[model samples]
Target: MYLFLNGEILHKEEAKISPFDHGFLYGMGLFETMRTYSGHPFLLNDHLERLQLGLDTFNIDLDLQKLDISGMIASLSEKNGLQDSYIRLNISAGEGEIGLRTTPYNHPNILLLQKELPPLMPLREKEAVLLKLRRNTPETSVRLKSHHYFNNIAAKREAGDDPGKEGLFLTKEGYIAEGVTSNIFWISDGKLYTPSLETGVLNGITREYIMELAGTLGIPSEAGMYMPESLLKSDEAFFTNSVQEIIPIHTFEGRTFPGKRGRIAQQLYSHYERDAQVLFSKNELHRS
Candidate 1:
């Protein structure tokens, strides 16, 4: 495999990082996961926008506007010989002294990694279980897709290795937070509902886009602190992320849901498929 690190593409095994890098030393870094459809990056601008916000919050100095991100993705795609792919754009604070510093990190390491992906199918299903491990509070005011990921890793282990199952997490206070690696949502009475960001859930990009899609379909959406029992009253439920898009939950807490057969899940996913086909940046979609 090959990766784009700094300004050049190199074999993954050949790429190197300093042991003193703050990102390595102290987990001071951020990353964004994106997917390409027919070689076009869906929601490229929005992902970068979120990435920029994370960089600002981390005190990592990097100007994305000066970089040709699309061009980079295209180059990596050609080099890796994959069109449908998973992309992780990472930026980490460069070398720093042993102690923590309040000063901004001027030099940061940027990396782009990709992996082949089969064409995503709409309404793909997964089973969810309430995890015993509670969601951890974000280190900052809002959660950034940063190097601090042990919480998610632990949740994944607790959920076990069933690829078709996703572990749902509740906040320390027992309010529904989100899936281990995705945001959770459910539909009831023609309305869509999800755990609010106040619950310390990561404000996922796809989560935001799904809410937008709901509005376009005239579906009222609400976000608030919810409990596991709420799924019992739900007609259908699904999970969302940049890569998986919309994953209909087939079962939760021993209760069965409509899953892929759900009317609302079908409608939202159909619209999601149509938009992904056109492959416009989320910003462009909003402008029109």
Candidate 2:
């Protein structure tokens, strides 16, 4: 496979970075995980926009406009013969000495990699497991998609012993925040509810798109602080991500529901599938 590091393509084995990079030493960096449909990236603009937002928040001055990422991604995909693949875009503080200061960094490290999509649990049904670990505090820097992933990794390790497909993270205040790598949503009384961004949840791109699709489909949805008790009492639950799309929750921790697939989740999944077709069609048209 070929990887894009800065403006050049290199063999995967040849891709290397300095160990002294601040991103490696201090975990000062941001990243995005995206997927392709029929060899075309889905929601490229949204992902780039979020990346820029993160750079702006961190005060990283990088000119993404001059990069021609679309062409680069297309070329890489073609070179690898990738039809359905995962793309990881990473921007990190460049090589720096052993110091806490950021001034030593001159150029940001840009890494783009494509890999075969990992096997996902067939969402033909919905399943979820409740995790015992609480999410990081609001002041604990959970908003940025930084390389500091140990917390989520630890939570997943603890959740591994459970029988569910995914872990649902709760805020320290006991309100539902999100899953380890996805957003959480539940249906109650014919309305959809999810945790608010103010609760320190990462504003996921898929979560935003799903909310917009729900609105268009006439599915009532809102984001606010929600307790586990409310989720347990809800009619149905599901999780969303770029790859998973929308997956229903059959069980939470040890609690089981009447159905594996919730009605609202099913409806939303149908709409999401349609949207994918439209996006691929548009991409094809643009290429033609």
Candidate 3:
């Protein structure tokens, strides 16, 4: 396997970073996980926008425009002989002193890692159980996809190793927050619902896109604080993330849903896949 580090593609074993980097010492780093379809990054512009927002929040000084992102992803993929792969683009505060500082980071480390994945598939169902652990509040006012992930790891431990199961989280106050690795959504009486950012959930890129897709499809969607019983009122439920895309829930709290057979889930996924294909076709045309 090979990865891109500081503008150079290197074998994963040969990659290295400074131990004193604040990103390593104090978890001062941000990352974006996205997928590519037919060599075109799925929503690359949106992901970069979010990443830039996070970099600004963390005082990490890096200009994304100076980097050829698409070229790098294509080159790295070719080096590793992969297509339709998972990509994790990370930017970390470079080497810093032992103690925390409020000063801006002038030198930041950039990395892009890739892993092979099968072609996009939709409606993979999973069972969701409420976790004993509650979602932790973000360190900052708004949540950023940073290196601070222990809270999620603990929730995953509580959820166990069953690949078919996902654990749902509630805020400390017991409002539905999100899935251990994805955002939560449910449909009740043809209306789509999800937990608001007020619940301390990360404003996921795919979560944002899902709401937009719902609006485009004329399905009324709402995001606000709600109780677990809300799921009981819902006929269909699903989770969203960049990599997994849309995951329809088959069962929650002993209530059975149509899962992949769901009308809304099926509709949203068809549109989502179509959008990705449209982008791929545009890239093909541009190349020709």
* TM-score for each model: 0.97, 0.89, 0.95
Give one digit per residue, the lDDT tens place, for model 1 in 1-288: 999999899999999999999999999999999898888887888889889999999999899999999999999999999888999999999999999879999999999999998766657899998899999999988999999999999999999999799999999899999999999999889889999999999989889888887786689999998988887789999999999989999998889999899999899888777676555455444654
lDDT of every model, 2 decimals = 0.90, 0.77, 0.89
Question: What is the per-residue lDDT of model 3 for residues 1-288, given as tens digits with 9 covering 90 to 100?
Answer: 999999999999999999999999999999999888776688787788889999989998888978899899999989998888999999999999899889999999999999987778756999998999999999989999999999999999999999788999999999999999999899999999999999999988788888877876799999999999998779899999989989999988888989989899999898788666444222222232
**Model 3 stretches astray by more than 4 angstroms:** 278-288
Each candidate: how many clashes? 0, 2, 0
Error of 2 at 257 (Å): 3.3
Question: Please, what are the lDDT tens digits per residue for candidate 2 over residues 21-75?
Answer: 7888888788988887676677777788888877766656786777788788888
Which wins on TM-score, candidate 2 or candidate 3? 3
Best by lDDT: 1
lDDT of 1 at 80: 96
Who is ahead in TM-score, 1 or 3? 1
By TM-score, who's the top model here?
1
* Model 1, residue pairs in steric clash: none
lDDT of 1 at 260: 94
| RMSD each, Å | 1.2, 3.6, 3.1
lDDT minimum window of 10 residues, candidate 3: 279-288
